[model samples]
Target: MKKGFKYVFMTLLVVALMLGSFLLGNKMAITTGDKVILNKSDFNIYSKTNQMKAVIDKYFLFDVDERKLEDGVYKGLFKGLNDPYSEYLTKEEFDSFKQSTSGEYKGIGIFITVTEDNLIQVVSPIKDSPAFKAGIKPDDIIYSVNGKVYPGDKLNEATAIMKGKDGDEVKLVIKRKNSTGAYDSIDMDLKVEKIKLLTVESKVIDDLGYLHISQFGEHTYKEFTENYEELKSQNVKGIIIDLRNNPGGLKDSCVKIADYLLPEGPIVKTVDKNKKEEVDMSDAKEENIPMVVLINGGSASASEILSGAIKDYKKATIVGENSYGKGIVQTIAPAKSFGIDDNGAIKLTVQEYFTPKDNKIHEIGVKPDIEVKLPDDIINFGPDFIDTDTQLQKAIEILK
Candidate 1:
């Protein structure tokens, strides 16, 4: 009877162990049953994605490239965020972008953008580049490339057509407004060249330091500080920061430059979705020199950050039209970092940054203390082209 009791006890223990394992598996939704139960919220969250995969696998006619399909799905997912600044970069595009950040590339070396009027406008031609040599001016509307007419919104497509192996020639048909107020077509034959991007251009104009930052890049702060130090050594009375047609770049670079220029204080603040605030502060010990910043509609992102900080701190007089007003901060990460095998990356808008004075300039851009509009005749003239820069004149006047 004792042996029988022992056998019954051992059998009950085995049954209990099995019950525990089953319960644990069920809790984790890991049971290999035909239909594993899931929490209602979790089911709702994943059901649409599962359904989309099922529909695509079943109804798609072509033998789809699984990789391309996956990329499309990811791109679509980000597009659903309804944020223009958020985007998924394909492997090739991401690699190209990485190359650009290094401040070197094989291209025509002109920054182009789609305007609000559905025109492909040249933001600016890199100084001493093939485009600049070929006389591709800012605000020039690109009508066609090599006889191919691309829609204005297809800025990337147009850019690709313009970029080719070094020494290759691309023909651009551009329309510029003539003195009579009518657009005149001009043909430009430009040869692609290896472009080494330079972000900072400096000169001393009548004892005032004139610094033109084309765009903030990875090496911008180093270039800026070197020029700034040289200007200070020259005993400059004041400074002018020209940020016209600057599409902006790395925020760290901008903040560092601001720190070097401004007195010790907060530079900018960023707030995430959870309302967690992160402030970037300046540690400069010297008093800020009298200065003026030049801005225009093309000034954006990092440009806004630097100019806004200066404006908020009363460090400089801001001159020109309203800026582009891109206040959202983007964080880029590789797909592998997020547990995906795709050799691509996502640039997601993770936070919104505010000026030092807690001013948020997202859709509404930072206003200038002194507003100066570019004249129609001189709009195409480069930012530092100097001859017809009324905005620069205004800045110089302010500094003086």
Candidate 2:
């Protein structure tokens, strides 16, 4: 009887050990197998991270959810990443990210900034967006959506709350302070629609033709160049290019427009994180046509590049307020891991751009030759801060 009992006990012990080994192997594979490699040396310490992760899992308050851990690991990995343009987006958030890339979404079409005071203030609304349609003006601070305060949240979250299925309604509670008085808690409901930006707005204001290039969209250069050709064919003597509230897009598109406008040598130069500088060359095309470019505080990135280049080359008259001072350039690189993280999209600020004169415009924005602020008559109507557009008028006058 004693011998039989020993055999059964030994067999049970052996089975238990085998099961434990299998569980441990499975755990290790789930947690540590899917690793990402970053180009930098700092990310090389991931092997040692396995021991640390095991400790964290043991001491963690709640059950260690592997999925959440995977996300945290990926996000933590990017903690050492220096670029602000590069970030990890959650699955749902990534799906809702508002990039001008695919170019189709809806909401009260306004770009807003989260202020230090926990206020969501409008930077500017796209021309004829739902925000413009619902009378949500610029400088209006959004306090809540559907009565839920969302301060300190991601801008994408606030934007998501405001966007929905077409014909759906979104309520926004806003706060605005100006010369009139303190108007707080103003509420507005805007209907969501399929929003497509019409980047180019052209018209003939007397002898000169006016073209407003809002952004460098996918087909911006095609539209811009074709319009210029039409203007030249129409015998328009002067041209005014309005880049007010224009945030730049594709670098090539900006260069294309610059090439058309200037008898170009160097359009812009880029210095990467490695401090390597590359000069972008341009072919002269729109050299002799008298031109004026209008800019404002909202003009940034590629917009600044184009305006700065034109001004440096004496190719066009720069009009209006100083441009928004973003001089960094970004390139999107693939994500390393295909499993936990979707291929990583890296937007490294590889270089700081310089104009033809080798002028650097990092924090200090472009200064227009003619400085003008918007008039109050336009400001009082809604939340919009109307820049007098006297500069645009001046350009038109010069062209005429």
Candidate 3:
């Protein structure tokens, strides 16, 4: 009876040891396996990311660039929002964007955007720029750069390809519509140089002042004031403010310029997502010059803002085709605040702007007082191709 009792005790002790070992093995597996199995109650937002990282670390066959992986994740996060105006900028891209806003850079000096058809279209070439000298025109489609086809998705990527150090040469193959409306490919050789943004161009024509504002950049107001003063000194009868193909810039600059042109009233108003309104008003001092503002399909953002205000105030007669309707205000912020490092940033659409009369021109652009379409043949010509520029002629006649 004593031997039988000892046998049972030994058997029970062995069973307990085996059970303890099994539990320990499972604990180690839960902590060290390629994925962690979490209880439903303990699962959190970050749990899936951790699980994915573990799985990739253990099972991905090829080496991965961790930095690129992180960038992809950041880019994917914004892309998932499905907003085209909102984007993730890399460190390099952010630096380039800053340079652009400062009104200086090394590039071909052209503004571009992706079209609804996914074609890369040149909004306009900066006045007296390498691209302008090369006869690059508005609505020109960029097919390839340096023999490599550029996907028309990121404007910054296309700008980067066109930019290089001084004396560097870049080749572009552009596809433009011919007189028959069929696309024709034209190869261009352009040399990169230090591009100083020239935002304002003015001339006196037949006792009238012609002022073309290519963009509303940092120096635009100062330039606009100087130009206006010079035109006023010339005792011009009227002035034409050309904003055609002007992909807009600084709102403050546009507002200040509008202040010089508008009477004592509200210039523009903006509303945030929280339904808060902020209004910008103009002082009593006004230019009061019989004026006309030119616009086209490429006039956007601040350009639209300026035109809308002028239209509301009857400050100028707007001419040309319908403007590009981009009434959203974009605010830039550092990516680090969103858990991204390496000096990256994002430009997000934060507010919607309206005209002083409370007209919203977001997707629907401001209609011109006189709608005139450029001749198809003249549309593809260089910036100086004014002989066939009927829109400018119409403005000249209006001012005359």
Candidate maximizing lDDT? 3
lDDT of 2 by residue, 1-400 (tens): 1243335445544543453321332232212234422222222254345556657766878776666566566655654464434456565545544344446666667766545554577755677777876666556788888778877334556877777678888888887676778775677888888778767767766567778887777778888877877887788788888887776767888988888777849999998868888988887555587888888876878899999999998888888789877788876544544343354444445678988898888778899988876664453211122235566657766766
In candidate 2, the residue pairs with backbone N, CA or C atoms under 3 Å apart (3 or more residues apart, or in different chains) clash, namely 108-131, 271-351, 272-350, 335-343, 335-344, 374-386, 374-387, 374-388
TM-score of each: 0.78, 0.74, 0.81
lDDT of 2: 0.69
Against the correct fold, how does model 3 do in TM-score?
A: 0.81
Q: Rank the candidates by TM-score, best first.
A: 3, 1, 2
What is the lDDT of every predicted structure here?
0.79, 0.69, 0.81
Q: Which residues of candidate 3, in runs, are more than 4 Å off?
A: 1-62, 116-119, 177-184, 336-342, 379-384
Q: Model 1 residue 128 lDDT? A: 80
Query: Sorted by lDDT, highest first, which candidate order results?
Result: 3, 1, 2
What is candidate 3's lDDT per residue for 138-188, written digit by digit as tens?
779999888888865655566786897898889999999887889999999
Count the clashes in each prediction. 0, 8, 0
TM-score pick, better of 1 and 2: 1
